[model samples]
Target: MGIVSTYLRAFNTNKLDPYPVEILKRVDKPTTVVLESEIPRLDERESGFNRAHRGDFGPHLTRERQRFVGKHPLSAALGNMQFTLAHVVDGIVAQEKAPLPNDPALMARHIKETAYFLRADIVAVSELPSYAVYSHSMATGEPVELNHKYAISIIVDQDWKTAEATVGNDWISNSMSFVAYSTSGFIACILADYIRRLGYPARAHHARNYQVVIPPILLKAGIGEMCRIGDIVLNPFLGPRFKAAVVTTDLPLAVDKPIDFGLQDFCSKCGKCARYCPTGSISFGEKVTRNGYEKWPNDMEKCTRGRVGNTKGSGCGVCVAVCSWNKPYTPFHRLVQWSMRNIPVARRFAVWGDDLLGYGQPKLKNKWWLDLEEVDGKLIVPTQAGQRGNHRRKQA
Candidate 1:
């Protein structure tokens, strides 16, 4: 057998060494519990939370409102609906496992069509490298192994409406996280079921519970290239304002080629995300060797610690919000990104122009959600004393 075939057989037999579980187990469990409990309360107090702890771009809630429509009931309902449909699709795919489908290309196309119909902004397939699956899951400290050889990476767009609403308060920002996670989870679950129905072994990798690193798989799938912000950068679309989920399987499919869009060159000069990172976790230097790869290395520990220490919410995405690449689907910006892809010299100018236009500045006036009177008929405004207390404890 060829080397690739041999490795595949070995992987299927579960002979590969699993990732160490101890690293994951080391996190303080009590702290996690406390964070989980605070998420909802934090969502309610988003404006107060931001007012208390101002960062480089000002109150995070204010910035969010400028970008998104805030926590609208319709958007939240749509997210939940998409999630439910994903589960239904999963069931259908699982039950239809074939006497083996005849054509791999046709099958892949159908899968992509189904995924797009289910609310995925983009879908692509690629061979899953053995290294893509982690040695262990950090959340549960569980030893994990993946025998699957293919992965389907799905990207979902964050609502521009909700992102615009973020500037009003913390509730809007937290709600976006809620929508993305819930929607991505549903997509992964359904895709996993679909692969299994084709008589192939499959598994869904969702947020905080993934076996595979998403960005690499996304790159392999021809969906997008890795940008300076260390996330998969989509083109002529949602840019960096998207979340990813993966479904690994043994299904046969064609792979995609990596695209060159001058992102590396642009990132070398543009430190927008690094500057906007509230925890200073993003890198601002040249790419360096880490685990045998040349890339920007982030301070993952510091990032997580910052999230844990946040008195208002579960996590942060200030880097994402402020990135020049995080553009809405506007004709003017689309033309700019398209031009930058073809003309290498225009990249630096593009980056500079984005900054000059105040692209990264937070907007305070768009705070529509701050006027919210109540939810479920009970008033939810933050008490003045509580707001003051949180502000006093803000980190410099």
Candidate 2:
């Protein structure tokens, strides 16, 4: 057993390397998709949840946002942690700049390595587009003026194990999101502070505090491509199964170009996300031009209602749960992922095979979490239909 343990540890271990997976190392420049655009700067207040908070979506949705945290115990706990961290996202930059290398390439590599050392799953750098910055803050309704030259995007994977165990809009839904949200936010905060210590202006952008829009940054940083799941960017590896945090910095670094993994074609062929979306929010039709980019546009009001005002669960992730791209990285799954990227015919067949193989259904035997909800100030087993959000009845 000792010898086997040693062999396994030595198989492909890199003490200095961050990624244990091989696919990440193969990702490089020269993006395949050509995005034509005239994107305008957006206000942070226009976001779905923010709209819910401001009663723009509806008064009922505003009430939903007020009680959003306490709907699920685990989600509430995680939300509190991230909200606390938001208070420390910005700080004073040091007066003197630290001595550093002249090469942007070297600096880029070093910064990425630092993120990896801090447990970031994946990191990419991009020249921050001015349009990505929000025109005003949602929290304070004040003008946002971020002029950072480079943006460091970091991704944290939401555990696939938990995703496999239950329905998309169950007690575990928001917990899946907050797990990635808090972890990525923690890493961004520390990375930003480290840059400030080096005499660079930096600010962390996470769930609780974001002054910048993420989709454009994700595209420009080679992180992923915009998918049919509205503005959500899907990575070749992580799919729509992860959350991201960003650090906007004046620190010099080499930026990566956008990547194309044939997601646009694949998403077009596979409508599994649309088929399984609880509120029928995802579009099952062709791409259309909205916000200067030609992509599938979803109903934001319905989607927000499905999430923030969900009576069936804490929040909905049916789209993420059923996406063809969301799969475990087993040997067979990896082979399928490669074919989906390279072979056009395979993309069509993979979609059919996913449904045939029952890839989207819940595996109840794997359930590990309690079906508990927090009401007022106590945690209790949700026995009634109303308490459990009447999700089973809704699905019927």
Candidate 3:
């Protein structure tokens, strides 16, 4: 078998059991929300600086603002997908009343095939180590039991056309994330159904219903290495232009080896993503041992708050939009990726050469859908933040 097939086989080696129906009895009860007075409106004055920057920067800024708001829509859409899957899985689990099929290998194959059918770019499965499960549940305000034994990691590709149209803090940049998240959610839902049909206990872990840390699971699945930006950088494919989803189950499965694509060395020297991060959430230095692993720890809270306070959008994707690895499926880029994968020493030079060639620079005029408007009367322009001047100082 080829390397890809070998990896796939390794991922598929697990057993499953009948779904656990009684577990549903332990599910936390839903809560009710009380409506307050009239909803408070966001202050325009508070957002004046962001708006002025947007206006001065032109259509790109407006697009960036729109992209942030659009992220919420995609997130909401993913939530709905999870909801539907959970309902289906709940019925299956209740009927089975025991651990479903315990074949890890079959479950892995089913996950990969179903995820691809649902539009995911790639899917891989790995065993969920005890340490991988959260020690505490933030939602329930209690410690979580490490019951899930496996995780099916899924990756969804971003729209390269829309990404190419980005101009920094524009709507197009944010839209890329939305597309990935929305697609990942759909893929997760489908995989959940497949597992249930195969007589296994499985749960879709999308944007809101995750019980596992997806990046680590993807790492174990050999999909990608964790970069300095604190995101998975898929080999020869998505780089950072993708979102991840996970499906946790009691199914037995084989685990994939962690990939070592010299990303650690590449990220150490290539700070383009960090430089492009508007909120400085990405680390600029070396990876450190944190919580028992080597990683470039990110300031997620700062990044999240920055997006919330921006007034123009709910979140940001400048780091993803500017990564050197986040390229489209062009022959030249593919050749470069192949070279970097085979020859590790050449990666540093390649990174330098790519910057010299302005490969990571966002194009403002490549807006294919700049003139397109939705039925809601909102014009879909590219974001201007993508076009911000390169802030990296030339290496001496």
Specify the highest-lDDT model's number.
Answer: 2
Off by over 4 Å in 2: 1-37, 384-396
lDDT of 3 by residue, 19-85 (tens): 1111111111111111212212222222323453345435555454444443444433444554554
Q: Which residue ranges in model 1 land beyond 4 Å of their true spot?
A: 1-101, 138-140, 164-169, 231-236, 312-314, 368-396
Q: Each candidate's TM vs. the true structure?
A: 0.67, 0.90, 0.71
Ranking according to TM-score, highest score first: 2, 3, 1
Q: Which lDDT tens digits does candidate 1 get at residues 1-396?
A: 232342344345342112111111111111101122222111211222233333323455344333222233434454455545443433333454577568887777777777776787777778876555666654445666668778887777777654543431244554555577667778778777767777666777765356666765676565555555543354335656678888887778765445455566677777777766666667776676544345666775455444434333323566666677777755466567666655678888887898789775555465454422223435445332001011111133
Each model's C-alpha lDDT?
0.55, 0.81, 0.58
How do the residues 213-298 of candidate 2 rate in per-residue lDDT, one tens digit apiece? Answer: 99888878888888888888888877899999999999999887777677878987877777777677778888887666677889
TM-score winner between candidates 1 and 3: 3
lDDT of 3 at 331: 52
